[model samples]
Target: MPNTVASKRVHVAVGVIYNPHGQILIARRHDDAHQGGLWEFPGGKVESGETVCNALARELHEELGIVVHTSSCTQLLEIRHDYTDKVVLLDVWKVLEFDGEARGKEGQPLRWIKPKTLTKYAFPAANTAIIDAILKPRDSSFSSH
Candidate 1:
């Protein structure tokens, strides 16, 4: 007989925030949560009836205490990964402009490091593509505005 189990699907909105100094922001997940203790770009799960941009803004604010200017935010890429228990779809965005300081409002540790140094930190498997997209040279398709 064939297996008939299906994993729950979770939609997440992720932000790759950058400062004027060219450093990117990252956060550590709570040690008790799924994929815990890994460094990740700050973000959270998208809620029902919410657009990815809206989710990004809300999650960023709730997680980092910063207001995301959705108009200036750019969709960098999307990634879907399946784990043993669940499937995650990551809607990644490039957050170049925002208001207020970025801090861990939820008590997670935060780090601002150069893009080249991203490899030094540990991230979930789903974030591998996000890291690649961040490290790759920005092409015309990716706009700063």
Candidate 2:
């Protein structure tokens, strides 16, 4: 039998890493990987017993070479998406405070994009909410810059 959505809520943590100059970070998924050829926030799966914040920090350090203290992240948004083969619970965070420079440690193409221009990149269907959060966010903290 196939796994049910409720039984397979894969927890993934992502960071909307912003720089002091007001740019958002994004990375390109490998062409041969799932959801390939699209851009996405830097993140990875949340292992058992790990909090979302911990996962974010771990993923960012591993994927982007940035050091994010778990407490420095603000809860941004959480979305659950169901594809044909799996269901993913994306725990997104807004990280403005962190140490180290951002680099694509995973060899993926990385960019720091202005928030208003986030829509130009091709992203996965599940990323629509995240894009909305960046572009037309209900939260007043985000600026048109």
Candidate 3:
């Protein structure tokens, strides 16, 4: 049978939203959905003709009820991953400032966790890079001996 899933590369915008307390926000993917039951940074697919940062700001507002200034977004990293069904290019950003409280606007479970404790939760394979990127600075501050 022909592959039902589209082979097109998907562009996604992910936000590692941070609060004043040094905690980052995460959300649980729907259990029955793709990469289900995994904790992921909140984001969505970037529609055609949309800039990556614009998409990030749009998704954040639509999914979390927050208005983010695209100009304030810090481009952090980009990850490309190919899953069995499709391929995705994840454009990750660090969002430290925004207006409004973040809630599960989509009814998904959301929580805040310290970056150093991210390993305690289960995440999709693509997220490993993000986790490492988030920890690199902290990792350097610790004594290696």
Candidate 4:
């Protein structure tokens, strides 16, 4: 019988972390993993029953040695992108308050670049929407959720 099952989408919690200098944090994916060798915001998948905020906090700490301030976290955007092999549902968040100096805990290279220069770096196709959102003008305040 011909297959009719739909592919499951990977739900990822992405963080657009801003430093005190207004720079955004990005990390390079391992060359062997999916979307390898491209720069991406530091984040990872959301486990079942995990809130987006919880997932973001977990991923950022695990991947980038930083603790996200959940109260300062805000949903920036949600994107659903389909690739040739996999679909992804990206839950993007703006993380203004965090603790510790950000580093790549997974041994990947990390970059803190001005948002205006985000276009210069090569990122996954799914990240295009995130780049656009970051460039758009908006109120950047640290209000509690």
Best by TM-score: 2
Q: What lDDT would candidate 3 get against the real structure?
A: 0.88
For residues 1-145, what per-residue lDDT tens digits would candidate 2 score against the true structure? 6557457668999899999999999999999999898999989999999989998898899988889977768877899888775788999898888899888887899999999889899999888899887777675556432
Candidate 2's TM-score: 0.90
RMSD (Å) per prediction: 2.4, 3.3, 4.8, 2.6
* Deviation of model 3 at 121, angstroms: 0.6
Residues 1-145, candidate 4: write the lDDT tens digits. 5432336668999999999899999999999998799999988899999999999999999988898899988898899887665677999998999999998888999999999999999998879989988998455433443
lDDT of each: 0.88, 0.87, 0.88, 0.89
Show where candidate 2 strays beyond 4 Å.
Answer: 1-6, 139-145
Error of 1 at 93 (Å): 0.4
Model 1: residues with Cα > 4 Å off, grouped in runs: 1-7, 138-145
- Per-candidate TM-score against the hidden true structure: 0.89, 0.90, 0.87, 0.89
**Tens-digit lDDT track for model 3 on 24-121?**
99999988988799999999999999998899989999999998866667777889988777788999988888899899988899999999999999
- Which residue ranges in model 4 land beyond 4 Å of their true spot? 1-7, 138-145
Tens digits of lDDT, candidate 1, 51-112: 99999999999888899888878888889887776778999998988999998888999999
Residue 128, candidate 4: C-alpha displacement in angstroms:
0.9
Whichever of 1 and 3 has more TM-score, that candidate is: 1
Report residue 87 deviation for candidate 2 (angstroms): 1.2
Return the lDDT, model 2, position 96.
85
Which is better, 2 or 3, measured by lDDT? Answer: 3
